[model samples]
Target: MVEEQEKRRSSEDEIDLIELTRSIWAGRLFIAKVTSVFIIIGLIIAFTSPVEYEATCKLLPESQEAQMPSLGGLAGLAGLAGVDLSSMGGSSGVMTPQLYPEIVNSLPFILEVMNDTIYFERQDIHATSFNYFKNIVKPSVMGYILKYTIGLPGLIFSNKPEDIISTKDDLSFYRISKEDWRLIESFKERIILEIDSETGIVEVMVEMPDPYAAAQIAKKIELMVTGAVVEYKTGKSLKNLEFILEAHDESKRKYESVQYQLARSTDRNRNVNSATAQIELKKLEYEFNLAYEVYKGLSSQVEQAKIKLKEETPVFTVLEPVRIPGDKSKPKRAVILIVLMVMGCMIGTIILFCKFILVGKRGRSF
Candidate 1:
């Protein structure tokens, strides 16, 4: 009977669910303290961060226009020869279009941009092209010597005479043998390239301190790319395409004249009933025809070249121009403040909860 009574008393001593809830409510101060801490830290991060403004433009690489005559002539030739030319139609004569975006980012292209004042003069902190420490050789060498005298280990590596020269005149020394390669690396760092995998539309983005400057740089890049494509497409290549056409016309006239004369000779010999003379005339006609064919092929190639050039001039349909940003992209104050306050509150709550659990555990152990 005594053992049964003791067991009943112990069962009744177990924690009650309602009582625990009352205890937790009594610890409202602990929850309030945790929430306060997180809010303060979040605000600090939001205010101090640097603001970055981005300018972006959309572009589609210029696609080549098919020269209908060239394709027709090739198809005709293939048909007459009883060969299939369907596979050739898919080929662009050049490499795949997929590779062009990377090619645009190549060193040569980067170097061209670097030479522009928009990139070189405005982008960097130094307002002028002259960074005196980089330009004047004497100051640079003296600085290096001074560093060496001061026991600076970095100066020991500066052994070459050119290396000792001021880096300002040509920053390419550190960039490697190629100026273009250096520019490419620098440009890549400053510019962001994004391409839509499905649509194949490209977004060229640049972030700068000034919104206007960012917009200008983006605009300049578009113009440069357009001009480059134009030059590449038209084999008239800085030369007038009209000139090549005129020369091609003259060649055609000369070839046709030779062909016409040979034809006349064969007819005359046949009319005279001279088989031997006819055979000789036939030989001349074959040669003239061969020359005429060569001239025709050359004429076709020149026209195709012109057509290809026209296709290379890339035009961008600007989906969105660079807008003057109203808000700075950095230092998201509200988010930072909220996060910091939440974290602080979490830490405080954890500390209070652990203290409560530890106190309860100690009392039970005692």
Candidate 2:
């Protein structure tokens, strides 16, 4: 008796699946029409979307300051008090690679990028990144729609553009008004920065409409960050170099003066046969030796300072040089069309399934 009931339920399940499949097959034309409409829409969107070019750069940040002669020194003693010796270019640990993204996105770093002059090959024009964004870069159709429609409230409340006054010598003095500030902040969206912990490599990527500009921006940000790191690491070493240079110069002058005086004294009393002459010669010898030793010590210090500077200035080894991507990084037209088509087909299939079930053809099975 149980075996017979199981067979009946199995037969009902098979019939329900067949009916569903048949219902889907009968409305295949409707499914095709809906899918075609979505595909057309997808094509329109894919073609109209802005083509974005990506530029990528990778670098390894190396700290060689500890290799400088006697890097630990008295900084080791001061470390007991929780004092950071990095301020004096000593034993303190170097900045971690993780904060590189923050540095790259920082206001000063972006400003440095803005000050750079780049040629937009496609547009056949020369302009700073900031100026190009301000005067050029026309809005896309979608951007306009969003601004007036979905983003209408935010756009209405946004600050008005400011008329900045400036001249050739004072271009940097223009007050960055609220609207300009917002525009400048928008640069953060076009850049990406990351660090690979396992490999200890820094990667920076930039996107722009023009390939050349994209590549330039990537390289420019790399240079700015490199310069900043080098400057920070070698700050104390450079100052030490300056002080040693000055001391070396002064000691050299004193040594020369002593030699000159001794020469004059010997020449003036070359034939003297008295104790006074002997005492004068001894005094000049003592002064000359003192100046020579001081000069020699300063010379050695000068050399040491130079070596320290070289060691402290970190070398940013480029693991991957910035390359102009051959294809647009966005829009993925084929994928977009496939997704839209699949969505349309699913909707059409569901509509057919509901219509067939609600007509009472498969009501008994449910």
Candidate 3:
């Protein structure tokens, strides 16, 4: 009885060890199967993903003082009004030129970008293509659905427009506006504009799927923005100069009339009593001289305004030009293949392990 009991205990120990090993090794087949599924999906994704190309353009912003002379002008004007302009010229306040970059990235600028279909389409195609591969191609179940139903049909029948200009003519105004805004926002996020603190230069960078399009849009936008800046500044300067000219003309007429009167009085007076009259004449002469000086000053100011207006306009020099890229930036195939292969192996192994566990249990029970 003691030997039989010992044998039964040994048998129980063996069973426990086997169960422990099986449980650990169990569903490895499932893991392998899942991994295999992932690998295959990854491979398909890598293969089908579209290629993207990038283009970049660089530029520098204009001089800070030229861009925002209002603060300086107002300071000078305040001094003339007998107010202490220096105190009001707050150094703590934000600089006006710093706000320019924000204006460039503003909604209006973004809207302008949307109005151009070429920019919008390039952004959309790149984004949508990547999303499709990542979400639809990677999941095992989704992979099956895509392969059996969507994949082949999409390759053959997908009618995604090649570029934005081609699609815009077909889209209604509302549709165009909506799609364009979306693309603009996306492009804005991708594009960068920076001002160098030390040199006060502006750097602009735009990244797009089409290298040429990216370069083209960057150049076009820079020119548009520069033209706008020039137009606005020039208009203000011209108006100021017009007023200055009018004031100068009025002062000149006054000065000339006074000088003529003074000249006639000096010629006619020849007696000792002419001394008192001469003093009066000298006083009027002084007034005339003062008016003449003011007119001269204003004329000089008009010339200065013209120069400032010209200099303030932003100018761009292309540092880099976009060229046709030989390679696309998208659809990394090797990564996708490795991921899918691992998934497939995990899935297949899990199935094999489940069968092994169930069969071994049934034989032992029988």
lDDT values for all models: 0.57, 0.80, 0.59
Provide TM-scores for the models: 0.51, 0.76, 0.46
Deviation from truth (RMSD, Å), model 1: 10.4
lDDT of 1: 0.57
lDDT of each residue in 1-366, candidate 2, tens digit only: 999999998998898789889889989998999889888888877887878899999998875543554546634543553434454444243767787788888876787787789999899999988888888888677667766898788767876645543436745555566656867788778999988889788999998889999999998889888887777777777887998899899999999999999999888789997899889988998999999989877876676566557656777889899987888887789898889989889888888888878875556566
List, residue by residue over 1-366, the lDDT tens digit for candidate 3.
999999998997798668756764775665665776687667666765545555555555444454456557754654464434333221122234356567678765665654554433434443332233333224345446665685676557545443443324766333233334444565577566676677655566665555655665666666766666656545665576678778878877887887787777767764547667878877877877887787667766655554454444444555655454556655567766776676577556656656666877898799
Which prediction has more favorable lDDT, 2 or 3?
2
Spell out the clash pairs found in candidate 1: 34-345, 38-340, 38-341, 39-341, 42-336, 42-337, 43-337, 134-168, 233-309, 234-309
Residue 165 in candidate 2 has what lDDT?
32
Is 2 or 3 the stronger prediction by TM-score? 2
lDDT tens digits, residues 68-169, model 1? 344566566555654344432322344333554575676656545544444332244432111211232132343355556874664454333333213366
For candidate 2, what is the TM-score?
A: 0.76
Location of the lowest summed lDDT over 10 successive residues in candidate 2: 84-93
- Give stretches of model 1 more than 4 Å off: 1-37, 60-116, 119-190, 220-297, 309-315
Query: If candidate 2 were superposed on the true structure by all CA atoms, what would the RMSD be?
Result: 7.2
